[model samples]
Target: MEKIKPRNFFDRMQALDRRYIYLVVALSIILPLIIPFNSKTYVTEPTENVYKKIDSYAGRKDRAILMCFSHDASTMAELFPMEVAILRHCFERKIPVFTICFMPAAKPLMDYAIMTAKEDYNVQSGIDYLSFGYKPYGLFLPILLGMGDDISEAVETDDQGRKIDSLPIMKEIRNYNEMNLVIDFAASAAVYSWIIYARAKFGVNVAAGITAVMAADNYPYLQTGQLTGMLSGLKGAAEYEKLVDIFATHRDENGNIASREFSKEILKETWIKLSDIQDRRYKTARIGMNAQTVAHVMIIVFILLGNVGYFVTRKKDIEPTG
Candidate 1:
C-alpha cells in the first residue's frame, strides 16, 4: 500500500500562476487566429441543415448567390472564421458567391473575409465570387429589389477601382433577379434589409450567420421560412468547421480539444473526417467551459491559500493585539 501526504514543497513550487493560466487561455484562442491552424473539424446536423438550405435554392451556373457582410471589425474575430468556413464550402461546391455589404465601413471586412477564403480555398475572384463592394442604399433596397436593376450604378467601381460590370463575376450578376441565395453574415439589423429586398421583392431564398446574441432575433423568420437557415456565432462556426473538414489546436466552448482526442462516439467515423461528436458536445453544452476551466481552477487554488492565511492570522490575533 502507498501512503499519501499533502502537496509537497517541490509540488507547490511547480504550480502555475493564475496569470500564466490566463496567458494559456489567451494563447489558445489568439494563437490559432494568428497562425494557420487549418484543422479538419466535421460539421453537425444543424450546420448541415444550413448547407442543405443553401443547396435547396442554388442552381444555374449564371445564377450567383449573394453574401452580405453587415458586421464590422469588432466582430471580425468571432464571425470571420464562420465566414471563411461558409465561403469555403460554397466555393468548393462550385457555388458562385457575390459578396455584398450594406455598411460602407463593412466593405473591407467583406473583402478581407472574401479574399482569405478565396485564397485558401483556391476560389477565384471575378468568376467564382465578387465583392459588389459597398452600396449606400439607405432604406431603398426594397424599391431596388422590385426594380430588378443594377445597384452598381450607385457604386460605379469596386474597392479596387475596377468597374464592377467589367468583373467577370459581376458580368453574370446584374441585380437581385440573378441571385438565388442571400447569405448575410451580420452583427447588425441589416439582415432585415435583405429580408425585405432579396426575399420579399426579389423572391430570393435567404440564409444568415450572426452572433448568438442576434440569433434569437432571427428565429421568427426561421419559423416562417423567411430565412432558410442560419449559423449562430462561434459555436455555429465550430460546427461548420467540422463539416468543411478544418480543425485547429484550440479547444471549443468546453475544455475539450476542438476535436476528439480519440475516435469514440463518432458517426461515420470511417468516412467523416476531422472532428467527432463527443469533442464539441461538452463545450457547446457548457458555453465557454474551456475558457472558464483554466480560470476557475486557478481561482479555487487562490481561495484555498487565502483561507489558510486567514486561519493563521486569526490564531495570532486571539493571543494579542500585536
Candidate 2:
C-alpha cells in the first residue's frame, strides 16, 4: 500500500494559510478597479420604479424632482453614486432638480454631487437646478410643512444666500404641486420623516435612495405606496446608471442594444429621445459594481474550497483501519 505524505495536498488545503486567502481577496478587489470591464447589471423592480417615476417627469416644467440629501460622509460611499445617477437622469431629460440638506454634514455632499454631475453638462445654478443648503434639523419639519404652501418662504435662500424666489426655476415651482417628486437619500432612517410629514401632510409622492443594509426597513413603505419607489444601495445605483447609459447615451452591449426588451419598452414609453448625446464621464457605480462582484466571487470560492478540504479530510480520518 502506498503511504500518504506527512503533508498531502488535501491536508495543506485543510490547513491553508489565512494570508493566502487575504492576498487573493485583496487582488480580486484591486484588479477590477484597475481594469475597465464591461459588466451587465440586472435592474430590480424597486430601482426600476424610481427610474420610471423620474422618467415620467421628463421635459415637464410644471413638475420637478426634489432630491433631499439627509446623509453625511459616513454613507457617502453607497449613497453618493445614487445621487449622481438621479442627477444625470434629470439633467439629461431637462427636468428641473431641487436639492435640500437638513443635516449639516450632508450639505457638502449635496454640493459635491451637483458640482460633479453638472461638469460635462451646461447645468447652471438658479436656472436649471437649485440647492437649498443646510437647514437645521430642528426647523426642517416646519420648513417641510411650509413648503407645501410657499417654497420660497420655507427655503428663504439658496446655498449661496441668493433669494430662491428670484431664481428663474423658482417662478414655476411654488410648492409640492410644481415640485412633485421627492427622493430622500439617507444612511439612517430619515425617509420616515419625509413619509410622515412630506407625503402624509402635503400629498406629494415620495421615494428613497438608501444603502442596501438599510433597504429592508423601507420596504414596508414601498409596499404601502407611501414611497413611490426606492434605490437600494450600490446595486440600485448601478442599475440606474445602466438604464441611463442605455437610454440617453445609446451605449450598446457588444453592438446589441436591444438585448433587454423591457428597457426598450421603458425608453419608448418614457419618450426619451436618443441622440448623438454621450456622457463621457466615468460611471462610478458601474465600475464599483465590478469590484464588488469580483470580491464576492472570490469569497465564495474560498468558502467552497474550505468546505471541500474539510469534507475530504474528514472522510480520511473516518476510514476503518485493517
Candidate 3:
C-alpha cells in the first residue's frame, strides 16, 4: 500500500474553510472599532483647499461659511463627520457659520451637527452661528436667489422662529456677499443648484461634502473653479479631522495654541491617535477609517495567500514521482 503524505501548510491554507475566513474578516473590522490605533491620514489637495478657504475667513465677522444640508440620514455616516469637522474648525477659529436645508429630513441632522461640535466650545446660537432650518423644495430657488439680495428677507426667521434680522450674526451677514462660501453636503448633485444660482448669480464660492460614490461626478466643477473645494466621502472627513487636530486644536507644552498653513509634507510626519481625541463625536471618521483600512488589508492578505497556495500546490502535484 502506498504511504499517504501529510498536507503542507500551503495545502491546508488553500483549502481553509470559508467560514474561518469570514470570521477573521469580521474580527479585523470589529477590533479596530473597539480599540483604534494611531494612523497616518495623508491630507489631499481638495480637502486642504477646503480647509484653507475656511481658514481664510477665520476670526472675520464679515465673512462666514454656509453649510447646506442637502442630504438625509442615508449618507450621514460619511457626510456627518465632514459637517462636524468643519463646524469644529469654525468654532475653534471664531468663524461665523450658517446652516440651511431645503428638505425637512435634513433639519434634524443640521441641528445634530451643530450640537455635536459646540459641546467642547463656548459658542452661542445665532451669535456665533445660525441655522436657517428647513424650507419647502419649491421655495429652494427663491430662497437661494433671495439670499443673494438679503438673507433675513429670504428665510425671514431661523429654525427657532426668531427673526434673523434681529440676530446679532446678521448684523454683518446680511446676504451671500458676507456668507461668501456655501458648502452643500449631499449624496446627489444637489450642489448644481448652488453652483448655477448661488455661485453664478451671487458669486459666492461653492464647495461640496458628498459621498465617495458621487465624488467623480463633481470633479469637473472643481477643475473649472465653479466648485471651490470638496470633502469626498469618509476619506475627505478623515483628512479634515487631521487638519483640525493639527492646526485648529493643537496646543503646545505651555498651553499656547499652534496654528499654521497646512501642507502635504507636514501631514506626512503627523499621526493622530484616536484615543487622544477627547470628543468622541470628533473621532467618528477616523475610527470608521481604521475599520475600513484593516478590512481591506485583511482581504488583500487572503487574496495573496490563496494565489500562492494555488500555484505552489499545483506545481507540487504535477511534479514527477521520484
Candidate 4:
C-alpha cells in the first residue's frame, strides 16, 4: 500500500476552513463593544473648529447654536453621536440650542437626539433648547430665508404645537443674528443650502456634520470659510465625543465640574480610557471605532496570510523532482 503524506503548513493554510475566518471577523466586531480598551483619538482641525465655536457660546443665553437635522434614520450611526455630543456640550455649559428639520423623516430623529441628550442633564424643553419641528419641503427655502429675519415668524409653532414666540428660548434668539451658528447634520450636501442662503443672506456661521462619504463635497466650503467647521463622519463624531469628555463631561477629584479649553499641545500628556467613560451612550462612537479598527486589522492579516500561502504552495509546486 502506498504511504499517505501529511498535509504541510502551506497546504493546510490554503485549505483553511472559511468558518474560522467568519468567526474571527464576528468576534473582532463584537468583542470591543463588550470589553472596550483605552484608545487615543487624534483630533482633527475641522472637528476642533466645531468644538471651539460651540464652546465659545457656553453659558450664553443670548446666543445659540442651531442643529438642522437633514438626514433620516439611515445615517444615524454617524450623525446621531454628533448630535448627542453637541447637545451634551451645550447642556454641560448652559448653551442654548435650537433644532429644526424640513423633511418628515428627520422630525423623529430630531426628537430622538434631544431625548437621548436630555437623559443626562437637568434641561428643560422650550427653555434650554427648542425644536422647530418639521416643515414642508416646499416651505423650507422660504422658512430658511425667513429665519434670517425672524425665527418665530418662520417657524410659527414648535414640535409640541406651542407658539415659538412664547417659548423662553425665543426671548434672546430672534433671528440668525442671535442664532450665530448653524450645524446641519446630513448624509448629503444639505449644508450648501445653509451656506448659500442663511450664511450669505443672514450671515449666520454655517457648519456641517455629514457622513464620511459626503465629506469631500463640503471641504471646499470649509476651506473658503463659508463653513465655520464640520464633523465629518464617524471620525469626526469620535473626535467630538473625545472633546466633550475632556472638556465638558470631565469632573474634578472633589466631583466639581472641571472643564477646560482644548489644546493639542497639552493633549500629548492627556489620555482618556474607554473604561473611564461611565455612560455607555457617550461611548457609542469610540466603541464603533474600536470595532472598525479591529475589523480592518483582521482583514489585513488575512490578506497577508493568503499571499504567504500562495507563494509557499507555488514554490513547492515549481521545485525539481527529488
Q: What is the C-alpha RMSD of each candidate to the true structure, in Å?
A: 10.8, 5.3, 4.1, 3.7
What TM-score does each of the candidates earn?
Answer: 0.62, 0.82, 0.85, 0.86
Model 4 TM-score, 2 decimals: 0.86
CA error at residue 113 for candidate 2, angstroms: 0.9
Q: Which ten residues in a row have the lowest lDDT in candidate 4?
A: 1-10
Q: Say which prediction, candidate 1 or candidate 2, comes out ahead on lDDT.
A: 2
Candidate 2 residue pairs that clash: none
Q: Write the per-residue lDDT of candidate 2 for residues 1-322, one digit (tens) a residue.
A: 9776467777998777989888988999899988757666777888878887888877777779899998989988789988987898888777899999988899899999998888867888888888988988888888889999999998899989999989998878899988988999998898898899989998998999998888999999999999998999888888787777666444464764322223646643543221222442436777778899999998898788888888988887798745
lDDT of 1 at 266: 43
On TM-score, the stronger of 3 and 4 is 4
lDDT of 4 at 198: 91
Each candidate's lDDT (Cα)? 0.62, 0.82, 0.90, 0.89
Residue 34 accuracy (lDDT) in model 1: 42
Regions of candidate 3 where Cα sits further than 4 Å from its true position: 1-25, 256-258, 261-265, 299-322
How far residue 321's Cα lies from its native spot in candidate 4, in Å, is 15
Candidates 2 and 3 compared: the better one by TM-score is 3
The candidate scoring highest on TM-score is 4
Residue by residue across 1-322, what tens digits does model 4's lDDT show? 8555468987887898999999999999999778776666888899999999999998888899999999999999999998999999999888999998988999999998899999978999899988888888899899889988898998899988999998888888888888999999999878999999998888899999999999989999999999999899888999999999888877889988888877776656768888877888997998899887888899999999899999987887798646
Give a tens-digit lDDT track for model 1, residues 1-322: 6545346443453464767656655765544444332343445444566766544434346676677778889887557777877776666666677676767778788877776666645666666776657767573454346326674564466656777677776666666666667778888766787787668866777777888788889888887888877777776776665555422223467865453222224434534322243443222312232333444566677577656656655554477542
